[model samples]
Target: MKLTLTPSTIHPPFGRYAHGVKATGSGILVASGQLGIGPDGTVPADAEAQARICMDSIVAILREGGLTLGDVVRLNAFVTHHDYFAPYMAVRDEYLADLRQKPASTLVVAAGLSRPEFLVEIEATAVF
Candidate 1:
């Protein structure tokens, strides 16, 4: 697995994830849906905030599986707010901006996430 730092016009690196990442292997990690729970098990109150936390959780899961965002070949985003497009893109670009190759992704809107506070959840599939 390889990790890389990317540049972006989006948000700053939150220190929770690499700007971009890459992985190579016979197989890659398939991340389960991540939640908004914080490292200390705290859940943020707002939808957008929780979405960021979910992204943070996915980052940790990818690292454990020996991969990074660049290794992600696909992404599925489940969001609660239709108006969150820009916020989501800002955060998304922050992680993907410098990737040499970009993953295919789709966004979906749901009535809600696992928790009422979970604004969004991103599940990923990686190919190495």
Candidate 2:
């Protein structure tokens, strides 16, 4: 897959992330932004829990897309606070541990998201 990263109109871009991303390919999967929908039948409503669940959801989508984590070519993480970085990153590493190929990534911090219960949101690009 081919991808393009764009700047966020609200927050100026720094070294960390692009404001947006665009992609085009022969055949591609635009995985929906996965929420931390857990077994309890409700979203955990915690930042770290949600982030981990989000990544898990991403993994599921990867499989559904006929790809694996190693196929991920780019990643974008959205969070409300930088303080959550360590724990969130730990969960990310746990899932991406054996990724044969690592994707380029960016983490975004915002004042708020679509929902207050959501602590983090993730969007990604994968080439398979």
Please, what is the TM-score per model? 0.73, 0.72
Q: Among all windows of ten consecutive residues in candidate 2, which has the lowest summed lDDT? A: 5-14
Residue 74 lDDT (model 1): 89
| Candidate 2, 80-100: lDDT as tens digits | 888867767878888788877
Q: What lDDT, from 0 to 1, does candidate 1 have?
A: 0.68
Who wins the lDDT comparison? 1
Please give the CA lDDT of all the candidate structures: 0.68, 0.64
Off by over 4 Å in 2: 1-27, 39-41
Regions of candidate 1 where Cα sits further than 4 Å from its true position: 1-26
- lDDT per residue (tens digit) for residues 1-128 in model 1: 55443323223343466534444454656666666666565776665676676577666667665667888888888878888766766777777888999899898889987567667777788876
Best by TM-score: 1
